[model samples]
Target: MVRTPLTPEERRRGERLGALLREARGGRSMIEIAASAGISAETLRKIETGRAPTPAFFTVAALAGALGLSMDEILTRCAPEPDAVPLAG
Candidate 1:
């Protein structure tokens, strides 16, 4: 089945996710992390660069496990806060 294109908001969320992953990675090599996650370095690279915005669920789970991050923590960090209010000009 053909996948639908990602909306702008999804792209933005993906960018946020990528940033969080990068921060969590710290000084670790990408290859090492990818291997530990049971994924190819290229796949990890794409996700980290936001080239692969919507990764498979299992892939994300594996990455989270390898990085010592909880899915809840990842979601909390990547998702926008519902209580955030826009500043009035």
Candidate 2:
């Protein structure tokens, strides 16, 4: 199946999510965190680097649980910038 290209906004949101996860990781090793989240180190690395911008919901939940982050926090932090104008169709 073909995948749709991510929009600029989606890219930005992914970057934000990546940064947030990276920060939350603190000094923890990527491998350690990935294991705790029941994912591969490479998968965590991709998400952290914004290479895998849109991960599966379960993957995100697992990561959040491992990082002690609430989904609400993620949603809030990843929200569009206040100054960003809505995209017109």
Candidate 3:
């Protein structure tokens, strides 16, 4: 199936998610975190680097569990700024 291209906002949101994950992963090795999350280090690295921004739901859940982050917090943190106006398509 062909995937639709991501909008710039989506890219920025992904970057924000990556940053949050990296911050939550402090003091832990990527291998350790990945193993705990039941994912490969490379996959974790990709997510953390925004190379694989749009990860699957389960993958995100696992990562959140591993990092002790709540989905609600993730949603809140990754949301676009309240004052930022959306561009007309």
Model 2, residue 69: displacement in angstroms? 0.4
TM-score of 2: 0.90
Candidate 1 residue lDDT tens string, 1-89:
99899988778778888888888899999999999999999999999899998888899899999999999998887776466688999
> For candidate 2, lDDT tens digit of each residue in 1-89?
99999998888888999999999999999999999999999999999899998889899999999999999999999888788688999
* Candidate 1 RMSD to the correct structure: 2.4
Question: Over the full model, what C-alpha lDDT does candidate 1 score relative to the true structure?
Answer: 0.89
| Winner by TM-score between candidate 2 and candidate 1 | 2
Candidate 3: worst-modelled 10 consecutive residues by lDDT: 77-86
Report how far residue 54 has shifted in candidate 2, in Å.
0.6
Name model 1 segments beyond 4 Å from true. 80-89
What lDDT score is found at residue 69 in candidate 3? 99
List clashing residue pairs in candidate 1. none
lDDT of 3: 0.92
All candidates' TM-scores?
Answer: 0.86, 0.90, 0.89
Order of candidate numbers by TM-score, starting with the best: 2, 3, 1
Q: Candidate 3: deviation at residue 30, Å?
A: 0.6
- Per-residue CA lDDT of candidate 3, range 1-89, in tens? 99999988788888999999999999999999999999999999998899988888899899999999999999999987577688999
